[model samples]
Target: MLSTALAAPAAAAAPRYQRYVALGDSYAAVGTLTKVRSAPIGCARATDNYPSGVAARLAPATFVDISCGGAETPDLTTPQEVPLGVNPAQFSALTPDTDLVTVSIGGNDVGFGEIVRKCAELSFGDPFGAPCRAHYTAGGTDVLAARIAELAPKITAVVDGITARSPNATVVVVGYLRILPPRWGCWPLVPFAIGDVAYFDGVQRSLNATIGGRAEAAGARFVNPGLTTGHDVCQLPGKKWVEGLVPTSLSMPVHPNARGQAHVAGLVAAALSQ
Candidate 1:
C-alpha cells in the first residue's frame, strides 16, 4: 500500500506538460540571429527567443513557436502575410493534447508601431515638448488608450480559443517589457521627445495592464516582464535589454536584444515552474 500510494504522488509530480505551443507577436520573437530557422523568414523567430528557452528548460516532448512580426490578435486565427511567405494561423498548432500555451501579443493591435512613428515624426518639430501626447490626446480623448480598450475583447477571445481548442493546456499570457524609463529618459537616443517620454511610457504600462487583466479574466495566468525596469533602450549597449534607434547590439531598433530575450525566458520558465 505504501509503494502504491507513493507512486501516485510521484507520477503526479512529474512534468505537467509534454506538448507546448507558443503564440505571440514580435516582442515574443525578441532575440539574436536565427538558430532555429523553423519559422518563416519574416516571422523573425530568433535563436534565443523566450519560448525556445522555456521549451529547452522544461524539456517538453514537443514544442512549437508560431510567433510572427506585425501579428495582431486576429492573426492568431488567420494567416499573416509576411515578406516572402504566409504564417499559418497560430491556433493551428493547438490540439487537444497540447498542455501548455504561452502568448505575448496585442501591441500591434493597439497601433503601437504607428504611434511610435507618428511620435518620432512629431518630435522633430517639438523636441522639447510633449508633442506625441498632445497629438494622440488632441481631440480631448486619448486615441491610443481607446484603441487598447476596443481591442481588449479580441485578446480575451484569443485566450478563450486556446482554452476551447486545448482544454488541458495551461495558458499563460506574457506582457511586453518596459522599453523606456519611468520619466523623461535620454530623448534623442530613443527618438522620443523630451516631454513625451513619460507619457508614452505610461501608455506602454497601461497596455500591459489591460492585456494582463483580460488574460486573467479569460482564465489564463499572467506573467509581467518584471525586473526590466532599468534595462530600457536608453541604457548603454552592455546594460540595455532593448536597443535604441541606432542599435549598439544585434537587435532591431526599439526591439529587445539577446539579453532581454534570455532574461524574459527565465521569467517565463519561473512562472511555469511556480
Candidate 2:
C-alpha cells in the first residue's frame, strides 16, 4: 500500500470590512473647494472633502462618495431636481454587506441656507436688533415648524433605510458644523442680527437633535460637533472652520472649509474606531 499524505486545512482569511461609502450634500461634497470629476472611484471629486479626509486616514479598499451638492434626505431615496453638474440620483451602492457609511444632510430640506441669506442682509440699526425672532416665529411665512416636521420623518426614513441595507456596516450620521458664533456680532462679515444668528443656530441644533435621535433608533452612530459651536465662520480668521457671509472665495456659503473638514474627519475617524 502506498502512503498518502493528508492535505492541511486552509487558513481562514481575515474578515474584510474595508469598503467605505460617503453620502450627503454640498457640505460633504466640498464642491467649492475642487472640481468634480465623472470618475466613480477617485477623490478627483472634491479630494479635499471630509469623507476624502477620513478615507485618507483609514485607507479603505474602496471609497464611494455619492455625495452631491445640495442633496437632501429625499434625494438619497428618490430622484431629485438636478442643477447643472449636480448628481440627483439616489444612492444604491450601500448594501447589507457594506462596511462603513456616513451621511451629512437635512440642511437643505429645512431651508437653512435661505434663512442665512435673508438674515445676512438684515439691518438692526434702529432697533438694536434685527427682526430675526419675529420672522422665525410669525407662524405663517417664515416659521420653520412645518418644514422641520416634514424633515423629521424623511430624515428618519433615510437613516432607517441605510441601516436595513447595511445591517453590519457602521452607519454614522454627522451633524452640521457651526457657521456662526453663538451670538453672531461679526458686523460686516456676517452682517446679521444677533437674534437671527441665534435663530439659525437653534434651527441647526434642532435638526441635529432629530438626526441623533433617529440614528440612535436605527442602531447607528450620531456624531455632533456641538462643542465647536463658538468656533464658526464668524470667529476670528484662524479660529473658524467655515467661511463667513462674504466668502474668501466663491465656495459653498456658510459651509465647512478645508480646516473644518479636517476637524470633521478626525471626529468621524475617532467614532468609527470606537
Query: For this target, which candidate reaches the highest lDDT against the unseen true structure?
Result: 1
lDDT for model 2 comes to 0.73
Q: Model 1 — TM-score against the truth?
A: 0.92
Could you give candidate 2's per-residue lDDT for residues 81-195 as a string of tens digits? 5544435454687866678899988888888778776666554451347576676777566567667777777767887788788777888888888776667567665777766
What digit string (tens of lDDT, one per residue) describes model 1 on residues 126-178? 98999999998987999988998987898899999999999999999998888
lDDT of 2 at 103: 90
| After superposition, candidate 1 runs with Cα above 4 Å error | 1-15, 34-39
- Superposed model 2: Cα runs more than 4 Å off: 1-16, 38-45, 85-88, 124-127, 139-142
Ten-residue stretch with the least lDDT total in model 1: 7-16
* Model 2's TM-score against the true structure: 0.84
lDDT of each: 0.86, 0.73
True lDDT of residue 70, candidate 1: 87
